[model samples]
Target: MELDDLIGIARARWRIIVAVFLSALALASAYVFLTPAQYKSTATVFLSINLDQNNLSSGSYALSQNVASYASLVTTDLVAKQVAADLPDLNLSPQALVGKLSSQVQQGTTFVDVSAQDHDPVKAQRIAQAAADEFRKEVQSLQTGLHAAATDAASLPIKPTSPKTTLDLLVAAIIGLLLGIAGAAIRDRLDKTIRTDKQVESATGAAVLAKVIHDSQASTKPLLTDIGEFASRAEAFRLLRTNLQFVDLDHPPRVFVVTSSVPAEGKTQTATNLAISMAKAGHRTLLVDGDLRRPTAAGLLGLDSSVGLTTVLTGQIDLSKAIQVHPESGLHLLAAGKRPPNPTEVLQTQATRDLIGALREAYDAVIIDAPPLLPVADPAVLASAADGAILVTRHGATTAAQLEVAAARLHSVGARIFGSVVNMVPRPDPGAYAYYMEYAPVANKQ
Candidate 1:
């Protein structure tokens, strides 16, 4: 990976990296404390030929050839077994204790180095000394007059050799760092959600009209622009309103349908807030409950919905008289009067088309809160009559496939899609706006 890629992974997954590293370090520390301390000791022995002055050169040549053989015998099972027998108090089997004994010698030298390791320093020292003594006795039994004596005896070591706590911890940290990098890369690959302005444009092939920050009080106060001043959310809707006016310079979209791929993607909320924002901005905005099956616009505005769109469509009441006005926000609402059977048939009628056309001419901007596209053909049918459609999607809650499907459904029928509005996206910090490509690589100096 390049330096930037590694930095990005570490930045995105730093928490996992730190947690794993600390966990490994903690385990290493525990092992150091709980495990018995191991100490190592080595006993040096020097050997030479017992040669007469007349034949010293010949005897030395023979002794040089025998040094390697003697060194090899020092750690053999034969010698190790004897050493084990001498340290019976340690209770180690000959085979189990065999690996701890080892011997080394220099080429053409009359010396052997015997080393031993044990949990107790004193035991290690005793084993090293005893192994050398036994090897000397074996040499004597062979009737070889070669001299052997302890040059430097094993001493008690003050420290342990097995745990190597610092080195082990360093190795563990490296392992943890690798694991974190793998996890971050896998997570980034597996995730298929569209989260950035770039991703939305790439996936839906449409410009973003607005990015509405998530608000906890939106459910209660859905009309963000009803207040006098525009907060961040209100300002965002105002921005959306301004963008809608410029969608077509010759003729802007007066009547538009607000719908999404599936329900609870904040389509209704977007419709209500956009209508209110437009009305508050001195536009005669009318919000119609196009979704007859599930009417939410009326409930959101706290208006009486006993008689509205369906009541007027069926000629039960005049459309003009059925329209209610919100005294606070100056917005108009035409609620879905009653749930009618065969909603698609009712919405597909030419009369429904004519009524929307008439409403479009009556108001400056008309926003219809239509049903979700994939669940039914109602939103598509309604979208056909409207001048344009505003696709609404929630951050992470809506997938790229769903947005594509919704766009394709609208496009198939030759409907005009104005743009998309990303709703309920996380609010950015003072210096943060990373919702879409929310992850950034941290700069790391090597």
Candidate 2:
């Protein structure tokens, strides 16, 4: 993925990334705290070649080359083997000793430094001295005269070289952080869920008519008065209502099927509220509970749940008797009465069509709250009967893939998608009171 995509993923999954990183750091800290302190010692050794003074010029250059060659030999297996033999107490073989020992040659100089790391300072010092002694012996074996003449020796380190706790923790923390970011990015790429209006528009190629802000007030009252107090949500519904008017009234979409990709996305609530709002504006409206599987409109609106659309469609009851008028707003309510065995067949019958036609002639708008699109074919069948359908999606709950599939299903059946409504958007700012201020003037005007 590109850098921007990686950045977006990181931003979205910041919490997960942080959690992972902190967890890794916590583990590293625990390990460091529990680990025994380790000390290291380094010894310095000088390598040189014996040269005749009569040929001093060429001898110095040759001696310098020999010193460079001796540094390479210090890292050889032969040197490691000899060092292991010299330091028996350390109990390290050539293979095991390689990790503990390191050698470096100084530039423009004939000195080579040998370093060893271990848990104990004395062991570290002994290992460094042993490796240096072994290397020195190998160098002298090349020439007996040089072995007898050489006076340079290995020196003991004044201080321990390791257990750099601060550096280790810093490096561990950095590694942990990078790993966390990478994991977060991967998760974001794998997630195909819709969380915003931007995703809906991009996926479905449909206009987002309105984004309804979540109002706890709307949940408490049957009337719009409670929601009217929150101007933002009320205004959003008003805008939706106005947009609905723009659709040609001659071939008007009188019956609108409101459903979602899944349950609990406020489809029923939207239908109820939108119907009430239309009724309040002096338009005769009817809200039908088309979801025979799990009906909830009757309870939500405090209406009698004895008989509704299901009874009327099944030819068990008459349409007039099945419909009930709301006491507060005069909006009609039609609940899904007694679950039926063949809900899809009942909905697709001639009786259902006749009932819808009768409701259309009687009411200005008929808003049907149908089942989820993905789980059943009930909503698609209802949408085919209705003039159009509105897909209600809860922000951060519904996914892009689900909505796309739902739209495709609707299109396959020649169902017109009226528009999409993004529900449950959180309040934008904490301090802003403009919505409340607008409500005050409207309330006073009312």
Candidate 3:
């Protein structure tokens, strides 16, 4: 992906990144706060060699060159042992003391520096001075007559070199930021869900009929009556209604099985509202509760659920007795009826087909609210029987993989797969709905 695309993904998944980043920073801060403070000190010394009268060739320069080489050997066991003997408090062995001490020589000069680190500032200064003194004595002894007596002394450093809080925090912040961005990228790559219309169209090759704005205020009631109060929800259903009218239905899709990949995606509400809207347009509409396992249409509309589709299908009651008419809109409802044991089998029967055929002849539109496709085969069976199927998906809840699998499953069974409906679109921009709402005529009281 390009940098801009990656940035967009990061923006979408920013919560996960911030969560990981904050967690890492908190751990770093805790580590820094809990760690013990350590101090460091340095001691400087000048090296020189005695020049003979017979062979006087820049004795000071030669001493400086020799000292530069010898400075590297200062951290060896021999120098450390000599330094250890001089200090009673510094009880560290040569190997153990190597990490705490360092030495460096100035270029083209006879000066060498020996640095020591410890938790205590005073002890660090004392160790640096003592180590340089011991090294100087050892060098003079080893050189014998080649070097003069040591004229220069080592001086203790005034400042501590460790516990650099500012530098530590700066490094920690950089590490934390990298970790955050990496986490966000990983999460974005791993997720295969479809949250946008472009993704859905790219995956399914189906144009988005409408982007339904989710109404926080949308209830069981139809959108037409409350179009003025809940403008977004009313506008969404109206757009969907207009789009359906354009579909080239040979016999006009009287039976539409509205379902989703999973539950709680607003399929039942969409089917119910769609049916109500169709009925309001002077068509005799019948909303069937095909999900016998967990029927919700009758309860949602506050209608009598004494007898419904199941009762009519089982020959216990006729269609006229089973169908319940809504008090507000003239739309009729066929509740799932008493939760039958074998809902899938009931929906696939020839009797059910004949009943739907009869309803299609009698009504202008018949919308069947079926169960989720993934969980059960009830919707698939209903889809096969219905004229067409409208798949409903929630914006952030449903994944691209799930939607594809659902559509493929419906297609596999020869179910007429109509275009998808993106439901529960939260807080859509005014521009998105402005174009659709402009076409809707202003309401007038008769």
At residue 38, give the lDDT of candidate 2.
62
Could you tell me which 10 consecutive residues in candidate 1 have the lowest summed lDDT? Answer: 436-445
CA-lDDT, candidates in order: 0.82, 0.79, 0.77
**Root-mean-square deviation (CA) per prediction:** 6.8, 5.2, 5.2
Those runs of model 2 whose alpha carbons end farther than 4 Å from true positions after fitting are: 1-4, 54-100, 120-142, 145-166, 169-174, 211-253, 262-266, 276-284, 313-320, 325-331, 394-401, 423-446
- Candidate 2 per-residue C-alpha lDDT over 187-301 given as tens digits, one digit per residue, 9 for 90 to 100: 7767777756679887666778778877777667534645554567776777778888876668777999999998888888888888888888899899999998889888888
Q: Which 10-residue window in model 2 sums to the lowest lDDT?
A: 145-154
Backbone clash total, candidate 1:
4
Residue 48 lDDT in candidate 1: 77
Candidate 1's C-alpha lDDT? 0.82
| Candidate 1 per-residue lDDT over residues 281-377, each given as its tens digit | 8999899988988898888888987789889999999988999998778999999999999899999999999999999889999999999998999
Models 1 onward score TM values of 0.77, 0.74, 0.76
